[model samples]
Target chain A: MTKRKMFLRMITASLLRRRSRMLIALLSIAVGATILSGLVTIYIDVPRQMGAQFRSYGANMIILPGEEGSLTGAVLEEAMQVIPSENIVGATPYRYVRLDMPSRQQSFTTAGTDFDEVRKTSPYFSVEGEYPQNRREIMVGKEVAETIGVRLGSSIELSYKPLASFEGEASADWVPGAALLGSSEGFNEAVLNVSAVLDEEGKISEIEVDALSQTENIGSLVGTDKAFLDQFLGKSLPLTLGEDVDALSGATISSQAVVDALNSSRSRENARLSENKEHYTVAGILSTGGEEEAYIYMSLEDLTRLTQEEIMDVAELSVSASAEELEGYAANIQEEYPALTARLVKRLAKSEASVLSKLQALVFLVTAVVLALTLICVSTTMMAVVSERRREIGLRKALGASDGSIRHEFLGEGMFLGGLGGLLGGLLGFAFAQMVSVHVFGSSITFQPLLLPITIIVSMAISAVSCQLPIKKAVAIDPAIVLKGE
Target chain B: MALLELKNISKIYGDLKALDNVSIRVEKGEWVAIMGPSGSGKSTMMNIIGCMDKPTMGEVLLSGVDISKETARSLTDIRRDKIGLIFQQFHMVTYLTAVENVMVSQYYHSMPDEEEALEALGRVGLRDRARHLPSQLSGGEQQRVCVARALINHPELILADEPTGNLDETNENIVLGLFRQLHNEGTTLIVVTHDPEVAEAAQRTIVLEHGRVAREVINENFGK
Candidate 1:
């Protein structure tokens, strides 16, 4: 019986003497703590569960340009700032353009897109051959290719249709979208930085660097193209990259590499020269098996070069937002910029909103009721304990125990009961919460480790406060009368 | 200055006066016994001396400090550090073992030590029954446990109210023998009882009648 155990023994002895009372208090406390932990777990995790459920249903929100003009890449960039960056998991812009196939002498609808964004937005894209890399190249859909009687490496002339310039308010807010995506890398400085291209023999070779457009093929500029030059210029050509060359006619030709005469490799024509063209190649074809298969792909820079319109005429933007947040996200965007219209896909958005709101309200109500019951039960039980221990209290007080010491003893007993109850309740609550989640939400719940201390503190507080009147009455007992023999 | 003094002390309950102007002094290490018939205010005086009750008038001085005017907390400290009490009913906390009951006094004073509490119980011949709860002990054994609890704090003054009221002749002899040993070692003792044998063992005897001191006498059998 050290001093510490002396204090603890007094409390435990008293509690153990009245085991039934403390056990009742403990049970009530445990029940209260369990409900408190379970409801809080459910409350915090419901949104995530609902979000996952909604994602399984498909696209949540879409952003369309204002009627005054089509959406620019600048507006898209600003829109990105307003929306949460991580939440916008996928985004792709669409612009419908027209093309003229000279073989048929008729125009057809051509959709312009960023193929990378399209891949994330629609995962179903299945490729046959390759997608187009530049303005001069195009990936003809199976139906379109069959109609045009074209195969791989087939290039069709695209009709030039410039974006109609927006005036007043819409154009006033625009930033050049094409400039945002284009890099301003200096070719001369870049070439100087490349120390050497090593060969298998460990010898160093100096390599020439050429500035290539987004549409240009980097392979065409790498090695000597004398064979290509001869085939294109209709004569055996001499290489004149570093110095002037004399064509067979004895005329001195000042040299810069010149690429001449182009035709699609798969075209039926023997040789049809192009008036003006970009270095282009087919990268890969996307066959989504859906309507996205019909859309042709190209970068915004390629579109600007081909149409001579330095604008991003994005008709619509597909934004990725979670179902629970879609409505709020759209509202935030509409509030910030009144020009744009945000439409919910409505496939699962309505259901997600309704379920989340009701869930939070129900959790709040259940937690409140349980807390009230716990407080009442713990308080009543502690009061009874104090009442039954009046003689013991009076004896201790007579033995030189101060009023404060008496109060601490009883409060310690209450808190000990509370802590025991809380431990039991925390475990019970985690199990209950997990079970509820599995049964109702078909998901596992997360446990908040912080609840253990909180439950014990709360229980102790309630029990101490409840035991006050009884303890005070006990403290006021006259030791003289209690000890006086009858 | 006397180690314990009661000056013009009076206790009243509405119209009834339990004590009236009772004054007495006991020197350091003196053993005194208080004896009286029913309604003689013997118990009331003990209560006042132990700081368990405040007198209606006059004062109690211990070590030259008037304790009757002190606050409840100070009185509690006085009872804890300076005075120990033993009741006829034993008043051992029922749920605690005999050793734990002894430790309770030490706990209230400063610190409780198992060795000190066990030694105190051994002094009263209850060492073998140290782990027995009050309900499990005989009346004599219970009284011995109470004595051990009172002695555990090494109080300056010990007030025994009917100390052997419930004990057999053999247990009474054992208790008196322990008090004789304590008196030989110079511990102040106050025994309140109707038993003449208990009163005769003390150095002085004070007799009360109708809340007043009827007579007081020095005892010849204190050490004998």
Candidate 2:
């Protein structure tokens, strides 16, 4: 037989002769390997699992208007594109405005948002009824509903009156501007300078008019006509000559021309600030114990139609990722859309990171303790075996075996046991990790195939190191004394 | 030239001298016996001669090489190449069978040859018991296996220390007969023993007392 085959045979025989002692060493190694494999698996998978759990709390990121005064739909879309879609749970945009309820003599802060995205970003919002479904429907906060004495299914009228800021000023030169002139038959033909201003209550505070060019008869009544326009001041918008004020008695065409020109100029000043009055049903009552309870919420589509403007003040996002990853995404968003500022909600991000880090540290400590104990136990058992085989070692040395060969035999036995134990422990460790994951997190874990080989290599290294002291003892045997029955 | 020589060898431990100024020599193909009482340094002298140890002072020349000055590693190689040892306890590896026990020596010396190991065992009349463990064999059978193991490497010298001390009368005769056969084949033999019958079987006898050689005697009887 070959020397290698003979060496293998000798060690195998030696190990089998002392099976009971070797079993204890094998068990220790397997247990250590199991804990090492299981804890490493848990350590790698914790962040992803915990990140998903933290998402249920609320949005952890927000995008607000940057240098621009407000955000637009294009900016929101660009921010969403910068963040990976798979990591985004929700992205909701909001716009706020204040409108008056003349019947109650009070104005309420109104918020325009998407209800579909609100379900993901603001899951804590509890509505008494339901979100607004149409332009004629709106949701009122609990504080607003109680103060206004409105319940579900009740109707409330909201009005937006345009300010009477003038488009064309009446200068002393009395030069009429064509762009400010309206399409009335006599109005377009005449050259008239008109100017107006509104008070905080949207009432016409001041009025001025100059008839630059007109018929000789009407031009003669210009001084009298200026005094007639004063009666229209202190009146609300959409004023009519017949309803709001009396017409000039003898110059009816000039009186119609003056009134039409002033109204046309108001329309050109602020297109969105027209006389908007709409009745909407109270669809839902929000009862959040925060600032959200003092406002009215409605769909963005409906708000856009009412105000004739499409914009958002801020966007809230619920993204499932670690704090560092969230920071990277925020950086990307700011780089791509400089007009938007992205920020993380530090309270939620810090708490998630803190809990995840502590858990990983605990697992690492436990694994280290287990491996140390295994090393001590295996070393002790191997020392006992070496003690028992003192005579055999002496005999081998006497038969011309070198110290190097004796050491090789003992180390080979230990490594072989380690390799076998590690393979068994690797399979058992995966199952152990799965059990812990399912029981504690209420979820299953994925298998990591790379851990098996790594576990085996570590196990073999530990076993080889454990054999050092025992092999030293074995090589120190003196054949003359041991064989002499001493 | 002498096949083995130890000139004024002194082995000391602290203040005690185990072997003081011991000198001896054995020619080629000679069967010599060393006889001594307890504490006479018989085992110590055998250990030095077998290359398991080195002397503190003096030269031990085996085939013209001074082994006392050789390093431990060099001594191990020299022992593996030229010396074979037989112990009194028949220290067979308890787990290995008889044939495997013989092959152990062959493995360390060179590549183990099962056929050669079996032939060595057959010469010692253990061919039928080659597969039995040491515990399963009788005292005589185990001793014969040791003999086979010591001869597997075809060493130039055979050093046997009380080889027949643990055997019955019939087993002792069997082992002595094997030694006689090896001696007849021109192999050198050195037997350290307390038995007069074992000493009388050798060609010459050396007696030691108080770590010194007191006398040497040669046998005059013919081979018959």
The prediction achieving the highest lDDT against the true structure is: 2
Clashing pairs in 1: A126-A287, A130-A284, A130-A285, A131-A284, A131-A285
All candidates: DockQ: 0.44, 0.55
Q: Against the true structure, whose DockQ is highest? A: 2
Supply candidate 1's per-residue lDDT for A14.
74
Computed on C-alpha atoms, the DockQ of candidate 1 is 0.44
Worst 10 residues of 2 chain A by lDDT: A172-181
- Mark the regions of model 1 whose C-alpha exceeds 4 Å error after superposition: A1-5, A16-18, A50-60, A63-324, A327-341, A345-362, B217-224
lDDT (tens digit, per residue) of candidate 2 on A1-486 = 999999889878877876788888888888888888888887777777787778777789999999865688786887788778998989988887665576874556678899889889888889999988777799999998998999999999875433333344322112222122221223224334445566665566766554433343454263246578778667765558788876777666767766665555533333222446688899999988988888888888777777677888788899989999999999998888787899999899889999998998899899989888888888998999889888888888888889999899899999987886687778778888888888877788888899999888888888998999999999998867644535
For candidate 1, report its TM-score: 0.62
**Residue A81 alpha-carbon offset, candidate 1, angstroms:** 13
Q: What is the interface RMSD of each candidate, in Å?
A: 1.6, 1.4
Steric clashes per prediction: 5, 0
Query: How many clashes (backbone atoms < 3 Å, residues ≥3 apart in a chain or on different chains) does model 2 have?
Result: 0
